[model samples]
Target: MKKLLCLLLAVATVLAMSVLPAMAEGAEINMFISSPEYADAVNELIAAYKEVAPDVTINYETTQNDYPTLLKTRINAGMTPDIFSTTSGKEIADYAEYSYNFAGSPAAEAMDPAVSAMMVYGDGEIHGFALKGNYFGMLYNKAIFEEVGIEFPRTLDAFEAACEKLSEAGYQPVTTGFAEWWVFKHVMQHFLDAASDDPAALVAAFQKGEAHFKDYPVLYDNFFRFIDLCVKYGDNKPLETDLAGEDAAFGAGKAAMMTGQGAWVEADVLAIDDALQIGFAGYPVTDDPAKSQIIGGSDQALRINKDSANLDAVMDFVNWWYTSDYGKAWFCDVAGVIPPITDAKVADMQIIQQGSELSATDGAAALSICYSSDSFNQAMGEAIQAYIGGTIDKDACCAQIEAKWVELDGAAQ
Candidate 1:
């Protein structure tokens, strides 16, 4: 009788939780997207979900800035979105109801807890579903490297030597779109992973304000060393150059080495030239490989509406994502995101390989970009751009971020 009662209650709970349109009034659901690259991939996922319930319209909006702040502004304006994304480090409790909590969801049971933890917020409340993960490393053009005779960087010193060597070879080496600001993020994270053997230690430091501008001089020194190379080899004024321009350098064969995380940009690089042989290598490890901590994690995520008219459809979408063969097939073939399911097969993902190989060394990988708050991100970008443009010296560059750190509530890290 007890077992029967439990089964009855389970069915009743699922029924009570999902308010289908037939039972209640429902209409268009808006989703605020934080990433633009995977919109095509997301559209595919959404199309699959639509088959489960075709009445709902997906109202989507894209933004490059902090979506959390946007969420706050929208809420303040009396406009509450039905669904949105809330990253682990940037959670706001007011919007909790609008997110999916993976802890108790069927979606959570089908995958690794760590990946699910990527979307976790509040007191173990999961806010989203993290799909494919990302990693940081160097992207070298095959033709450019071969013509210049520069091999991928294996060690810190070796990378620096390559930077100097590439500069002398009439090749623009280590180009970044500092003008776009986020370009510096991945490289900084990679440098942190190399210098601090503990990936979580970096995350822990960021949360506790223990890391500083000078805590790891290697990043400061090596990054500046790289910036020096960029100034010498750039096709034109690098200060005015943006990520689009930086990408053009690689595509046009004007630059040799570029840093990237496994984001949607992979598609663009692959599309540029059929013959553009691309090789990816982890952030330059320290002299000792074991000490090289892999610093990156869950690439991006999909969240749900807390007040959805149909919880079943949302859960259906998430469950299908990990368990259904059709969902997995689309993700693998179209999106290239390795679903959380353990037995899920993944293709030759360069970023995953970079992080996985490092993990086998008995270390961890935390997404490097997760280290700073939104304000720190902008400040650091400004500093790097100023330094490259010669408007700020090394001391001024360091001081700029230090001052902004104090201004911003990010104590350190």
Candidate 2:
């Protein structure tokens, strides 16, 4: 019995020795991102990265709910990932303490200036690089538009006229998921863009408590215009329709158009009916053609953890991701995004082509930057709902947003 036990122990020790070298062949770099929906795309990227660096394993992790809270908690506990995901602006600012300064990287050199401006810290160091961008515009059913004999609207009046036409054709002019608070936040992005092309200045002023939403008549007027559109064109029970259901509704041809939609919605709609042809156009909020623009910016950006144990391996992957064909493929093909890098190749998807054509103009800007991080969207959503339901006037809704912004600004200080 004693001889048998010794032999067994020796066999186990030899098996452990054989496995250790295989494990040592690669360094496992942990990556944390928030969108579980991107699992397939992310997995494809991970596989591509493995092909380039077989010695480095990319450990990708994702969560869909309360990601920011979980990320902050992880950082606070010093359980830092090798690579982390961030948005372009204030989100990167808040995570700057744990992020590496990538000022000298190839990715930094390849970034669009506007994107760089958003990702750079106050100290003049770039903390992150935007990999891909998505645009927000009016996504319309091409077949529906053809049937109604109307072109995509380019001005507020034209938009309203088209809505009337759509309504006359026994269709909902616009499909909106106002029941979900985040939908309003995303939809209002176009209205905000039409009000000010350079919203960073306005956002800064509001942050400093020097500007009010009511003080800017263009913005104030646009707010009411948006509310009117919602009430006039939205589904009978706008508040009851959810985002997922809304996509299905649009794909099913229950509506003629969807305003303030992004590329993902196109994908969602297509998933329901592959042959459904869709078109993209700017959500016109003003009579001035110059103010009518597409809303877009860094949809997803990557940041490196400064204290990563596998910093070298992580950076090697980052360099490959930003410069290699694999990276471009991941952005252009796998993720269905327009790569944020200058001169980056774009996917041949028709929806992407339509969005790119609209984004080429001078009016394209990132409108989400103007949103205050603290409950501002929630407050605005509530106010917009009140206005839509006739519980409050337009002025009251605007005032509520202003007050919420001011209150949040104060709390931040």
Best by lDDT: 2
Best-performing candidate as measured by TM-score: 2
Where is model 2 poorest over a 10-residue stretch in terms of lDDT? 367-376
lDDT of 2 by residue, 34-117 (tens): 767778888988898778788877778999788778888888888888777766666667778889998878877777665676
Candidate 1, residues 174-236, lDDT tens digits: the string is 766666777676666666666566755665554455666576666667656656655665547
Candidate 1's TM-score: 0.78
**Colliding pairs, model 2:** none
User: Would you estimate the TM-scores of all the predictions?
Assistant: 0.78, 0.88
**lDDT score for residue 33 of model 2:** 81
